[model samples]
Target: MGHRARSRTRRNCPSLQEQLVHTTFLEELVFWTVKFEFPQKMVCLLLIMLPDTDYKEALTQAFVLHYSRISMMLERSTDPDTLSNRVVHVSVQLFSNESLAFRMAENLNLLHVMVISLKYMMGKILIQNTLHDADKNFHYVVDCGRQVMKEHCYWPLVSDLNNVLSHRPVAVKFMSDDNLLEMWFTFLAMFQGMNVNQREMTQHVEYEPNTYYAAFSAELEASAYPMWALVSHLIDSSSIDLTKRVLTSCLIALQDWLDAINFTHPHMNDSMQVSFHLPLHRYFSVFMCQAIKHQGLSLQEILPPRDVLTLIMMHPLRVQCFHWFPTFILTITITIISSHLISSHRDMERMSGVTWATISLTPLGISDEFMQPGQRMRD
Candidate 1:
């Protein structure tokens, strides 16, 4: 009787590989499982019971599976857009579980794989956008351009990454320790073509916001939104040291962007010039205001916003930008100046500096009331 019971117990247990495969399968079941409360609870229970090593294995395999699909799609051998999208869709679902997010990001190898994939996809996008076809109809071409920007693999992936980090403080801390923040900053700077010295005259535009030039610029701005969103998450951290570091890196990135713009703007036509109204530029003031209020940290402790503003204004590109991007620069300049003023306000100690600055800047003078509690930015 004892021997028979032992044999049955052994048969009931799954092997390690089976467990890993089951973990991966759960990602696929998210949609169906989420529709019914009991199934979702069961899936969550299984996730909780899974060992760390098996979860990591599942994650690695998931990345490999999606990357392979993406490669095939790019090759035009087979269009597996659905398969590729599962990568992001599954990731977002997985990140909805904080424990899973922690496990996903805690592995340094996983972080590298994720970031490298992001960079690869973005590089492909930049290459595709740089080579425009002039033969296509203007409206049709603009629509196509916008579609590519929206449909590209990088778009959803970066958006998911931003969303994940926004809520997952543990994951953010892990990523920051791995220098993911700096990597993102550097990538954004290059993605803007700030590092490329050569500039070519683009096909000219007849009017603003209606031409291919406008579409192209809008695509650039849209692509940059995630990076600034990540910055917002970082500055919102509780650690003064981390906030200080983020502010400094923010300044460095802006200076690099300014220098590159100054160098390239002169050679480009009005239609092709990079706009200063990108998310990174617009959000810098908010970041500064948040940092100033972080744990009562001083402006001097964080990099001075005035210094960044001075750099932007003093750059030779500024005069040309004022001519071409007046509304863009003026809007951001006012926000930054307002933030600078709010930082010095004695009431800042009593009220949230970010709320104060935001209310003052808004047209109707309404303020965002929700202030998330801060978390440690790093280990």
Candidate 2:
């Protein structure tokens, strides 16, 4: 009776289907082994869950998955633009574990694959950021209602990628079909990260109390966009496309900010920070210097026409910017002083110093109350 029961159990079990699927998977693995000539250890590590497997497989699997993912994402991103959040999660998960991420970054092949994936995801997120809700009629979900951007779009992926590059600078992947697309995508991604926005990022805010945060985002982008320092070290380009794009985006964003801040119809509330646009000329100086010193491109090629610069300088926005700085500081001095980084080869050091300076000056930037009578902030 026990033997009959055992026989019945064996017959009823779904081993036949499971074996067929398993066998097919193994056969495909063998085909990959033969076609790609992938290392046995690497293939085994990727295809199976083994005890104490080497991380190289994780890196390999990430690249393999990324290639397929990119193809899928590109196809779906047409017309209707179906950029799945799943791709974002999958891309980030590859680097979720700290140990594997660093290790994966160490390998050039893995790092290249990782960067390409991030470039797409970053660009995708940015499109949503720029065009949201009924504003542009996009199908993708807004990152979050409160923030101008979602954390996943910038943090850890872009931030950690920058970190990894700082430790070990890698080559640009050149994976995009054209160089212009490559530059624009990378620049936009890196731009999103130039300013660190939130606290702990993982925790969501119910709503940003001040709507200025949104305007401030564009304002901050305009201010910082001039220090397009990453362009020289990161891209392999002689084209004016990147420089043109940078100047154009910065100017347009600057205009948007100017319009937002200057217009009285909207009316700012009392809760808004008082000295938000103070020292705006300092960023304007940094942009000119950094662009001229890009090393890869000529000043004439990268910068707007002299007449254009003169026009911008004379604009109502630029004239109003002078009121923010000390009386001793003039518009020409703001544009003439230039960035120290323009002369030095150490882009990283310059950025670090600038970041530190920004941090140190934050408290000074805050105001408990407006100046008494005509007291100047530079005092």
Candidate 3:
């Protein structure tokens, strides 16, 4: 009787083990399917299960997952235009949820990345959406812009402006006031940071003469576009404080460039060589001239045409073989004096001689026409 009972117990134990194995396999399959189907729910569940300190990594992972999913959607969609517009829609919906903001603020670095990604995605969306239906799409863009500024203070949002400026299509027009202000402050912060970093780098170079000026020049040149955009916006908005800051930064940057130029080629120390300087100098000069003009300054007020020409001629690194400064100075000076001659006949004669003297003093030799005293009387 004891042997029979033991045999029966062993047979029932195998059946019980089979049942347990089958139940475990089914449970595993169900869990994976549920995880695949409801990722956000799973994330929320995990967040609830884990301690608060562990939420940062989970939040970052979730943000990255969303970004990946959006990217995949953008790639797979047949209609990029519609998909781009939808990106803003999705961002707006997420932003409206207060809980997301709280979660984002918990991890500032992740928050920065998320905001940058959203701004970039939204900017692209506005551009694409406005391509066909500019009026309607622009209204939507303005709304989004306002929402962004309202939700995220303008100053904090500035951290992402450089990326937006670099990535957005240059041709896209900004119509919203909020967009304009956001851009303005962002640009301000970007240049401000760049200026700080550049100064630090420049200080390092003071002891290292072997450091190539070209390397520093390249770094300065990289910031030109963003600087121009900032200055241009300040000019457009007529923001005096912002404009002053831009001018101050510009002067600092210009002084640095001048130092680099002088360091690289000490021979061309004269101001006249400014015109004959490298292509970058010419580009920067042109931008400066335009910026001055936009600010309503006459050419003479900033610096006489002759002086500008002289600076160009004296620039040591003449990329061009011919010294065009003399001709350029003479032409511009003549035009100015001619325009002035009509307004004030008496002042013209005296002004022409003074201008001629200025040009001659510049690194360039004066033309025979200007040198001949009697000739100046008629022309």
Query: Which portions of model 2 miss their true places by more than 4 Å?
Result: 1-58, 61-64, 67-153, 167-288, 291-302, 307-379
> Tens-digit lDDT track for model 1 on 273-375?
2333343454455455665554565544544454455444322233233243434332334443455535556644533443233222232212232112221
Worst 10 contiguous positions by lDDT, candidate 1: 370-379
Give candidate 1 regions above 4 Å deviation. Answer: 1-85, 125-150, 191-237, 261-279, 293-295, 303-308, 314-332, 339-379
| Poorest stretch of ten by lDDT in candidate 2 | 264-273
lDDT value for model 1? 0.42
Which candidate's lDDT is highest? 1
Error of 1 at 294 (Å): 4.7
lDDT for model 2, on a 0 to 1 scale? 0.36
Q: Which tens-of-lDDT digit does each residue in 149-256 have in candidate 3?
A: 223222222222332332222202221222233332332222111111111211223353222232223223323433444445534324434433433343344344
Give per-residue CA lDDT, model 2, range 1-379, as digits (tens). 5346434433443221123222344344533443343444645445455233554444434343334244323334332121233333334444445455555544423444434444444344342322111253222221222222422223323433443333313322221213323333334333321222222223445554443344345333322332232343433345334344444555544344333334222122222222222223333444444455543554334445443343334322222322443243223334432353344546446434433332221223323344223332210
Q: What is the C-alpha local distance difference test score of each model?
A: 0.42, 0.36, 0.33
Q: Backbone collision count in every prediction?
A: 0, 0, 16
Decide which is better by lDDT, 2 or 3.
2
